[model samples]
Target: MWTTTPHIAALSVPTTDPSNTKCYTTKHLITGNRTSTQSEQQLPTYSNASQRSILLATARVIIFNPDNGLQATLNALIDQGSEATIVSEHVVQSLHLTRTSIAGVGQGLSLADPQYYRPKRVDLIIGVDLMAQIILPGIKVGAPNEPIAQNTQLGWILSGRTQPPREATHVVCHQAVLDTESLLKQFCEVESVPERRLNTAEDVWCETFFQQTHKRQPTGRYMVRLPLKTIFDPSMTLGKSHQIALNRYLQLERRLTKTPEAWQRYSDGIKEYFKLNQLAPATTSERQSTTVSDSQHHCSSCVLPHHAVYKEESLSTKLRIVFDASANTSNGRSLNDILCVGPTLQNDMSAVILNWRQYRYAFTADIQRMYRCIDVHPEDSEYQRI
Candidate 1:
């Protein structure tokens, strides 16, 4: 086997042509004291400490060279901006070099600097001029062994210039949470209605809500139930059936006198009349012979004899007469000024005379306090109060 030996030599300065000078130039020396070699050795060019630091710290820098031209400068800027140094076709052509696979032709001008040397593992590249234009001042850069420079550049480009740092807050209140809690407490503290009333109220509220929400008016009539006991009574004046008929007649009279149009429609197809019938009263011998069954049936019966005195006119004729009487009583008078007539002979005579002109000739005597003239017990006059 052949033996290998190292060569060593003194450092020497590199030579430069004066005609190629474009910017400031510097001389560098290279030394190989560790190894011995017969061939000439290459030396590293010396750079200014301040200048090197400036270049390293600069996020963006512009360079102009006579020999390299603007295209080369643009390429160099793009290479500095990008993670990987790129060589363009135009750059190679300007430098009088042949096209190589290592270089790629990219569309649109980029900020990558072609002069900046980058490792093969780098995935992205950009230019210093582009970075200076895009990146905000708030971002941190140049950390040792940090891979976030690319991320920082991206953030700066998207977010624009960063703002100055804000002072820290000493105290803070959870206003949103406090407000939410207050509202919830108020809602929980509200009293709830009983289930039955709640359901009714909810139905009414929903009906109202629908009406208001849809801008529709409510429609339908309200009905009220009247007690028959409040109108008719068991008294000596008339039979129960007669009292019932009279009560109905008075009710119709009130309705027609108060609201003629509404009453007219209500009574349009109805009929009214009086019928007479006869029955025998229970005698003492009959009562003594009456069994418990007969007593059970007759206990609530009246003692008066039921006799057929007169068969009144047809229901249609009675209604017509009643309507005519109401009209006559209401003539030349407003609804508010009209007086109510009771079921008395004097009132009935007046109504009959007012209704029939032929009856005006009968008994032309004027009596004061005609209603007061009739003696009525305090309890019996309750029905007439209305």
Candidate 2:
């Protein structure tokens, strides 16, 4: 059953860290109270307050501890006042850490006097982004009809908040891939794209997200459908079958005569294409039937559904072909209805762009007529007849 309501889906992509990224994983042992620990497992530490914030940091936190790392209990609290993770000055100085800078996010570094003795207290303040990363037993981090923003609003209203110590300094930490609600909102809504360019927008968004979240280079053999042999092997326009001859194209010349201004350059382009490769005439009268049985057959014929749109100043022109591969000739199926479209595998464009940025220079090329260059297998030519 289907409903008319539009369904929304969100995928929270996990960030990948660098090989050298300083991070650690620690799990809490069930220990009662600060004094009641009888087992070897370390009990999960809590802030001075008993109740946890809506945005709670659980599991092992990957932190930057300057002095060979230290074991301490960090607090998790919900803060409606600020989106950044806030830490005390003592934690900053004790660790003597040089933090990474996140541009455009508010002033995150704030200083405050230590009010109470807490373990590993101030080196890093884990808030919303970091909290969302951790998944606890009872609560589903990502749930139905649950907006994190709404949760933060309701979280602050319902949960207890640990007040920052007096004279506390506020600092918003930044790394390339740390997940945040603001980042998601900004990525999806800020840019306005035309309806025709929605795919382009999606491509750009994926690329940005990949750059932000991933650090290490990808390693492993890619199981791409295109084989090394096929890619490296030059495409052939002519197979062994000398029986078939390349069809001569006159439509472009006919169209060019009507528009004399763009005729010379466009004509030259047409000639060059003819010399370089072979394209069979769609209306070739040699009348062939490669169509599967029980289908109406269509003869190749020429019609004025295509054009050579050109620029008057430069005489640059692009020839367009309008294909009616699905037309019902006495048979029911079309060329498109029978031929295989093959696989649809595309690399993450964003990841490609991200890796390109590491180099001092970058370049791109758009090869035209790529499909026509690939030679179909000799045996398969019959099925491919168009």
Candidate 3:
């Protein structure tokens, strides 16, 4: 038999025998504008095919108010089938909920995997939209009887079939239907034309900086200075990063020990950097020099730290060395914070594709080591130090 929970706004499937008198909860939920045609018809009925229980994916999460920093812990159900994450009304009543402008940027309250929504009794179903943003590429598999563990930004989630309770009798049949209306709406939004906007003051400054400082070498390669703000001196603001880099390197070494192939690739990539003159060893004077005016703490010129980002699907490079330009310094400001982000230089993908069809022959290619090809000016090389 099929029944609806008015409060949760989800369809629940029950056993065929009424005497069983037991029901199991599931993460799959459908919520959106239901068409009149769909609403008018009687809800379709479903029955358990067999008396077998299925395991549902679930995790414990903590929710917090971004404004006051108030925290609450709750149980959450991870549902890849659902379109949107949902919270019970009870959660809103308990905490001061406010709408945030940042969406898909991981700044919104619901986007945080570590802490999400809902109460103890009610489960917060985390849908595909938010799940895709916070998920990291890490997974662990164990023996047949053991639950598989999947690593996420929130933490490790253990999920798989477990032994059912002795008293449990009713079996569960799961079904997650895609909302046609929501899919159609998303399709329309993707096809819609984006509005053009003017560049901000910072963008204008970045443009001016590029035009004034950029140079071309005899080999036809372009060199540019880092777009640093005039207000703060980087040498003074940035703290010593030797210890931080050492700790990160040690952790990476431990992880790489398990995968010799990955370790070899990482070593080869670093060697290429030095061979191309993109990286070099610090001079004796450069290493010893640590002078800052009006600063109690010793600040280093080379304060950048980096980590390895593994992408098995990448065709060219599997392991990428991503420098942490956004790492906070002693004053809580970062290299990214002091730099001006320029306006996007490329046209929209829609415009590019539209023009592509006009050509007699269409060819697709991507630049190899695109960023590494460009050189930083000698004066600004210190800021680019890793």
Candidate 4:
């Protein structure tokens, strides 16, 4: 039969007699969206003309040792007729379960033959020994002392894995209990990568630091700066992403420059953005525009290429300029060609969602022109000059 548990979808096949049962659980890795009607056509079916099946029980058990405070969830294939509980190799490493080796893989073992195992890719076979650690709830069930026959078909799933000759281990199943209250503990935390923080004082420093520069220095006007070139050594080639961005920018520029209506809207957006942030030097005249090489930044006075993405659902102009700071130079150095001796920071979505779940009524707040408003150091401005 077919049915689903909280964590898995499973099918149970009953033999000629209904008293004994065998169950197998499988989880799909499908992404995107589809309806049941569409999925029914794509789902695989057994070819042996197997007898009709019924869904059976599945155990989503969380195993742990209370004394040492170790815990993890195990989605097991519940086979009552099978002699003992088996654990997959991934479980041992992922959940840190303890195990011991008893036998080596051989011709008689599951997925042991190179010809069969190569195609099947069977890495770990959980034997009866792991029954010692299969933490079940209060349900009591009979355990058979039957030994697994050689050359039996077996399958297993892990979070994810790669590399052949799968590494596996067998944990001792102490006892299967109905619940984990006495043995397992649960906890959660957020892991955000470190990122650059804006210097609060530097936010307003330009109006404060007005030295008479050798050139382009007007006493009263605030100095606009070019952001510093990122010092980075790219270990990877741009592949097709750079070309895609370049094409996108070219398309955006072509439409904006040729279509007066499109150009008017785009220019209007730029004007408003510049007016609000006071960042535009002089409403970029044709004289200020510079041509850049498609392959690299060869323009004597390069302006960072720009691009836009449209949101059809929105009425406001979603037009935005892309700052290709990572574009490679003739020497193969992009803005980020150097390394920052610091930890990176990024928000942890899981933790954010967890914290958000605790509240009811909520609202989102955003800063307008957040990145454009940040000021860079004066000495490093030449590198960012367009």
Candidate 5:
């Protein structure tokens, strides 16, 4: 028997006499006595799944009113893509929603594609209604020769948005929703060593190691070991250095117990130490190095020395370039010549390099590292140099 309420739907199967009315709600009559309920509050109230399906299947052509705010127009497109609604920037601003700037101008473009164009900052909103008017206005359906191409437009669809409707105003089960539910259930069922057990084992290991070496009193209850080197040499094992760090951390944790603020400082210090040495926690996907080889390199003509190098290296090693202090100037020379060898080296060097690439071609002629080496020239000095 299936029963539905405004807040819940209940399904039950009788185990006793099939025709008995009293056995319907009786807990003992059902196997496992399970009652399943579907709640109106839990289910979406969209007109129907079919309507949503139609909306997703139908390609929308948006016509922008340039006279209106450009940001509003872009926001409408983004909102529609994500939430299945079209909205304008003015509406977003009026609602006072937070807006983030687009990181780059051209978002969906291949490195080799010449026709790729990136837009300036585009505002995003959630919901189909927000973009419906922008992309599927009555005028767009009548115009056939417009520049819109389905391939390019489809890529503009944001992945983060809700699953598209199969049809407008109708509801249908989406494969994505089913897959996501299965994944969540699988995750919940997975079992691993509990954090408490791991922490206890680590504590025991440190305690035994410390007692064997240091004759001093082991007064602290908790212990932590900090690695000295970022990269652990295969031949090397935990030695006196590790023991000493463990003792220091235990002592610090003990001393800071009285002051909450000092405890935070101690915790921060430990994290910073690990981060600086690159000996932090390990993630599920271990860090790997990847490299690629190519015969040709392309340089951007818009900016001086804006080029990428083609190199052959192991797939495990990643290839990146970093500019040195010399290339960090306003000088007109291309900074592309300066390259750092590895990821760690690039990150460390980036802090020292001040000058950066600009959009204008004229700015590319400025001396590199102009900030560090060049000084403001006096009238007399300028005339003498000239």
Candidate 6:
């Protein structure tokens, strides 16, 4: 059953660090707390009294502590005016801390300060820092007195002034104070002489993988394996894609038929691929075994769908075959999805330009079929099967 009320859904995304990301998982149940936790704070020990009342903007949200895989539902204050986001100390204390290390932060930094202790009633305050990330673009206002609906990554939140409470006598005013000194210190840390750039765990693994797997062939061409993530193996999830590749090939043929010049270039390119030993026919046994049905029995070879790309501006080799590694298999994931994209090894463009400026003379040379120069490792070639 469904209701006509406007709503937004929080989409679940796969992540290596689920605790850190705002992703939803069904492993744990998260329910909102409707009962409010009320508290009163007086600046000068209740010297002033008020007779009017105002509505406070609060939304029920599930707060997750990725550090300990603990999640709790609480009513959060939606303060768009505040610059910093803060959670109650009690909320942090309530969540179990099994691990000492935070996801991406180094061990030395301490975020806790006794000076900024918030009252228990204010369970969570979603200030500008987090609001910028979670708040989605759209606002729905119904009638003149209804609560305004605001969209966020978590879901739709209902806020704004509703019907005033008849029993309300005191006007509750809340003030948010930001620590400028701490913020300035953080800003100075970012702006000061920079420390050595630290590579993430994934980046280190990618570098190690390249060093271990990449090799130079007798012909001076480099053969490298696709840097695939270990957690999500394509062989396990990849579905029957032979038909998909075949359909894409047929579509390419139809598209090429419209332009005979492009068709001839494509045909010549295929012939060149065979002539240069870049492409080869599968053996008889392989052809017999590698089929749509055979895929279910074992880890089948991936069939990469390819098409012609025409770059008219290029002085040499205007046409090329572009393999679509990102083409979706029967399963939602693609080859690109599982691959850990290795870091760029080349120098920056700015550095190259600076070097060029220092040199008395400079000339440019182009490598013939530069894109095809790198050879895929033999074991990894199945992933690039066309």
In terms of lDDT, the best-performing candidate is 6
Q: Candidate 2 — which residues are off by over 4 angstroms?
A: 1-256, 263-270, 277-295, 298-307, 311-334, 378-386
- The collision pairs in model 6 are none
By TM-score, who's the top model here?
3
TM-score of each model, in listed order: 0.13, 0.27, 0.47, 0.31, 0.13, 0.45
C-alpha RMSD for every candidate? 47.8, 31.4, 30.6, 26.7, 36.1, 26.0
- Ranking, TM-score, top scorer first: 3, 6, 4, 2, 1, 5
What is the alpha-carbon lDDT of model 3 when measured against the actual structure? 0.54
Q: How accurate locally is residue 62 in candidate 5, as Cα lDDT from 0 to 100?
A: 34
Ranking by lDDT: 6, 3, 4, 2, 1, 5
Tens digits of per-residue lDDT for model 2 on 1-386? 21111111001111363222111110100001110755232222233344432222222233457566753444333333445665444455556655554543322222121222233222344456545544333432233322132232213211223333345789999878766998887787645331333345434544444345333224321111111112222221111111111111235456678877667655564455346533222222223322233343232211111224464454323532222223322333333333222322355566567688899999887645433333332222232222
The 10-residue segment with the lowest total lDDT in model 5: 24-33
**lDDT for each residue of candidate 4 in 1-386, tens digit (9 for 90 to 100):** 11110010112233576434232211111011010343211111111124321222233456675656777754443343445455556556765667877443322112212222222222233444553344333432322321122212222211111223435888876875565653343221124433445644432332233232223334332333321123122332222122333344556667778867667766675466445542323222212333334554332222233444445466554554334444454445443332121222345556667678899976888655444443333333323322
lDDT of 1 by residue, 17-37 (tens): 523311110011101111155
CA lDDT for candidate 2: 0.32
Residue by residue across 1-386, what tens digits does model 5's lDDT show? 11110000011112365333110000000011011774222112112344331111222233444555332223223323353333334445655554554432322211111112222222323345544443432221312321222222333321211233343587788564358888887786553222222334434544454345332224322221221111233222111111222233345446667767655554563343235431212111101111122422221110111111223463431221111111111222211122111111122233223233332333324342222121211211110000
Model 6 residue 292 CA deviation in Å = 12
Residue 256 deviation, candidate 3, in Å?
0.9
Please report how far candidate 6 places residue 5 from its true position, in Å: 46
| lDDT (C-alpha) at residue 262 in model 1 | 45
Instruction: Write down the lDDT of every candidate, Cα atoms only.
Output: 0.27, 0.32, 0.54, 0.35, 0.26, 0.55
